[model samples]
Target: MTSFILFAALLIVAVIAILLPPLLRAPKPSTGADHREANLAIFRDQLAELERERENGSLALADFEQAQNELQRRLLDEVQPAASAPSETRPGRKTALALLVVLPLAAAGGYALLGNQQALDPLQRQARITPQQIEGMVAGLVEKLKENPDDSKGWLMLARSYKVLERFPQAAEAYGRAGALVDQNPELLADYAEVLSRSQGGDLQGKPTELVERALKIDPNEPQALLLAGAAASDRQQFALAADYWARLLAQIEPGSEEAKALAAAVERARAIAAQGAAAAPAGQTAVANGSAVSGEVTLSGEVAGQASPDDVLFVFARPDEGPRMPLAATRARVGDLPLRFRFDDSMALAGGKKLSDFKTVSIEARVAKAGKAQSSSGDLFGTLSGVKPGSQGLRLLIDQVQP
Candidate 1:
């Protein structure tokens, strides 16, 4: 406010400085100095002509004198006394003063009508809106949305704001509105799916999962959709599918982001679970192919063994040594079962016609998670051995590396 007042004062002063001279200047005097000066010039010229006439004998000395006296009399008659000369009429000072007043007022009125005064205020737009004020604003928007249901972008923004505030139900409603307006928009679909999941206690199996799938169909690499899809698959115990979805998401995300790091662990854990499921074949199925069976025992390192609880999950798996490093076979056991024996063969394959025997060389890995979840999180212990040939016998795996 103080700054504004100062600016206004300075502006008025500058306007006055520019206009005052023309408005308040003293009227100049209208003297007869021009008339008196003209008469004196005529008299001098007449005297010069008279002297020339006498020298040329065009007139006698007496005639030149007489002409000079006549010229003097004429000059006296033309010249007026300064005290009796009339002063020219000066323009009214009142008009100039009126112009001075009108110009500033017009300028000020024009600015008031057309200038954006709010732009000069640094906090006028958003900075002054506090959290509580924001909530009120959101409420106002909600009311507006109720009145006008066709504002798609408004609904989207409202949904996002509600999501930030953890008002999942309201967010879901707004997201629905936005999604309805722009079907097949990947970001909207994914956000709507996520909000719907949250509103329903984080259950992604039904409509939420369907929404994510739809979003992915529109944009195969949409990161949020891929993540939700992976989570949904994991919830359904389709660990391989979950891993594949997360891997695609990981490739598109910033590699150094916290999300990517967490996701990398998730992919690893999924592969481990998938491997385990494959290796532990359904009842009545033939044991994994014997031709390429890899048998190994996982033991916890003494240095980190104390961190595990009996209920903690342990994952052991084998992946391709060369290309498309998805797990071929895997199995899970409790940490209490560490130093336990495990085997991988065709029965443990992720899908039919794919098995440990498909690759001559393979990599083996083991991870221990305290949460008992398949996806690895922070503090999980893991270790790996690369370039191992299939059917290797009596191999010993150690769980040593710690996920940071």
Candidate 2:
């Protein structure tokens, strides 16, 4: 900052120096004697021209005399007494002094009004803002928005602030208020969908899914939209659609980047699932129609069995060995049903167009959910056996570990 001020001072000094000389120098004065002499010379030329006109018979003798007298009278009228000319040097000096004072002040004042004074201050530029300060600012914005509800930009800013604070419900409400502002913007739509999904316990169904789809339609390569769309398709067991969405997303990322590598891996998994589905379509259909079953016994391990309650829901499911983690087939029971026989079949598929016979190898899992939710949560007891075939029977599955 000191260096910048010094440099600016030097520039102002240079500008003043360049202008001072021109302003200070007095203008050449027109003296009375010089003016009278010039008038006499003009009178002489006029008299000579009158004589020539008379000799050429263009003027009468009386007319020639009148013309010469008129010329003399005009010269006399133009001439002034040769007196000392008033000094202009004083005015010039005053103007120079005024410029020296006013120019620097004007320049400084203009810069103070328009320039970024804090630009060179490193401390000011690098100051860290605390989370509390940010929240205060957001609160201020919210109050301002209340006073001016038509401010769409303010609403959008508030929405983003709420999202950053993980206040998802409030964020969704603010995004809704953003209204038409979010409709045309793909990034805004994607962010709105994310917040809305978070508000719904991370379920990107219904309105969130619709928003994701709308965002994708506007910009096919919108990264967040594509991610949400792919996840939604995977949740629906539409592996081919998920693969297509993820592949498009992968194409948009820079090669060799970590994000690109991760997306590429996801795309590959989705494609593997889609390929497996294609290969098993006919057999899976037939198996579902024929009611083929994979019967097994689920027994809780003595080591972890003490954690289970009699009424805790037990979920037994089968998923393909490769690709998305969605269940192909599942059955529900209670913790009291431990050491119970379970009949898993294509008929118990979790989603349409997917069946127990849809993969070469399937993994069977049994989870005792204390919260009675299908998804595994903390404190759940679970176990798994991989490489089980669709018609495998008399298999013993153990519920061994506690979900962390």
Q: What is the TM-score of each candidate against the true structure?
A: 0.42, 0.42
Superposition error at 74 for model 1 (Å) = 46
Q: Taking the tens digit of each residue's C-alpha lDDT, what string does model 2 give over 94-210?
A: 878988899889987998899987887888889788889889999999899989999999999999999888999999999999989999999999999999999999898889889
Q: Pick by lDDT: which candidate is best?
A: 2
- Which window of 10 residues has the lowest lDDT sum in candidate 2? 80-89
What TM-score does candidate 2 reach?
0.42
Which residue segments of model 1 deviate by more than 4 Å? 1-128, 283-404
The lDDT per prediction is 0.77, 0.80
Candidate 2 clash total?
A: 0
